[model samples]
Each structure stands twice: as structure tokens, then as C-alpha cells.
Target: MRKLTAGLFHSIDGVVEAPNLFQFDSFDDDLGALLTGVLGRVDTVLMGRVGYEQWAGYWPNAQVDDDFASFINGVPKHVASDTLTAPLAWQNAQLIEGELLAFVKKLKQAEGGEISAMGGISLVRQLLFAGLLDELTLMTHPVIAGTGRHLFEPGDPTTRLTLVDSQQTAKGNVVSTYARRD
Candidate 1:
């Protein structure tokens, strides 16, 4: 079965939204290597409407020399959106058919490389709680983002996860990977 995974640029205070605002200072070569490794393992990308739209607007037209531009532009993207229609403008992107969770469940059964849930906070949360996401990696930057949306909010159901791997980058970013405890 294909593994479904998600990685987030997180802050010490748990903020996962808009890492671009706070992560650049600590984004070092080690962190870049980590992300590149993850990208290498992933052949399919999954994202919500917001991330899809945001990336579609940029990556496709971004300079070819950009590290992520070619990879993101070429990879197959499946977008989960209630409002978006088929034949998305982005190359290799398409709206998901049927129920989101059901579609993911079936996709997991299909033979393929790793399926990555990219930069979609809501989608990652849903997948983690629904037990669909096989792994979650948090590249926790050493900073306190005082105001931003967090990946886990108050009143969310308790979910137990086992740490599978962790490392501290030279620039003080802590990369941690976890798997749900079944």
C-alpha cells in the first residue's frame, strides 16, 4: 500500500500556517536536504483548495531554475475542493472525485510511490485524525510565531503518535516524524 505522508514547517508554538513569514532565517542546507529527500520519495501530491490555488498560481510560472518549481510543476496533483471544478488550470492537477476520505482510502490501496499531503493544514488535520495519514513530519523552527493558525487547536480529540525519527538541523530547526499509535 502507498503511504500517505505530510510535512509542515512548524513553529515552536505550533503555528503551521504561512511558514514563509518565519522560516526563512532557519531554512538551512540541512533543512533543504531533508525536504529534497521527502520530495524524492514522493511521486504524488495531495493538497486542499487553498494550497492548490496558491501553488498553481506561482509554481507553474516560476523560473525553471527554482528548486521546487520543476518538481511541483511536473508531479501529479490531486486537489480536494468543494468549489473547484475539473480540468484545473495547473498542469497535472485535477479535482478529486467522490468523498475525499473515501478517495484517499482507495488511493492508499493503489500501487505507487509515497503520496504527500503538501501544505494544507485542514487537509492534514483531517487525514491525521481520520487515520489516513501514515506519517507526519514537523520541521519545527526555533521561533515563536505569536499570531497564526495552528495545526492543532484546542478541543481536538486526543491522538497518540509514536516518534519514529527526529533530528536537529544546524540552524536550530528540529525535524520530527511521527506515526499514529494504533
Candidate 2:
């Protein structure tokens, strides 16, 4: 079965909304290497409506030549959205059919490389709560984002996660991997 994993740029205070605002200084060679390794294992990408729209608008027309742009544009993307229609504008992107959890479960059963859920707090929360997410790696920066949406909020159901791996970058970013405890 293909493993479903998620990697988010998180803050020390658990903010996962917009890492671009706070993660610039903490981005180092080690962090870049870690993200590259994650991309190496992922053959498919999953995104929520907001992330899909944001990335579709940028990555397709991005003038810069980079590994991320190439990989994201070339890899197959499954978008979960209730409002978006068929014939997605971005290359290799398609609207997901049927229920989100059901589709993901079926996809996991198929033969493929690792599946990555990228840049969607709501989507990641759904997958994590439904027990569909296999691994979650948070690249936690050393800053406190006093305001913004967070990955985990108050009153959420208790979910146990086991720390499987952890490393720190020279710039003080802590990259930690957690597996859902069953």
C-alpha cells in the first residue's frame, strides 16, 4: 500500500497557515535537503481547494527554473474541492471524484510511490483525523507567529502521535517526523 504523508512548514506555536511569512530566514541547506528527500519519495500530490488555486496560479507560470516547480508541475495532482469543476487549468491536475476519504483510501491500495498531502491545513486535518495520514513531518521554525491559523486547534479530538525522527537545521529549524499511533 502506498503511504500517505504530509510535510508542513510549521511555526513554534503550531501555525501552519502561511510559512512564507516567517520561514524565510530559517530556510537552510539542511531544510532544503530534507524537503528534497520528501519529494523524492512522493509520486503523487494532494491539495485542498485553497492550495490548489494558489499553486495553480503561480507554479504553472513561474519563470524560475527550480526542482520544486518542475516536480509540482509534472507530478499528478488530485484536488479536493466542492466548488471547482472539471478540466483544471494546471497541467496534470484533476478534480477528485467521489468522497475525499474514500478516494484516498482507494488510492492507497493502488501500487505507487508515496503520496504527499501538501499545503492544506484543513485537508491534512481531515486525513489525520480519519486515520488516513501515515506520517506527518513538521519543519518547525524558531519563531512565534502570534497570529494566524494553526494546524491543531483547541477542542479537537485527542490524537496520539509517536515521534519517529527529528533533526535540527543550522538555522534553528527543527524538522520532526511523527507517525500516528494506532
C-alpha root-mean-square deviation, each candidate: 0.7, 0.8
Q: Give per-model TM-scores.
A: 0.98, 0.98
Query: Model 1: what TM-score?
Result: 0.98
Model 2 lDDT tens row, 35-99: 89888999999999999999998898876578899899999999999999998999999999999
Query: Which candidate should be chosen as best, given lDDT against the real structure?
Result: 1
Expressed as tens digits, the lDDT of each residue in 113-152 for candidate 1 is: 9999995899999999999999999999999988899999
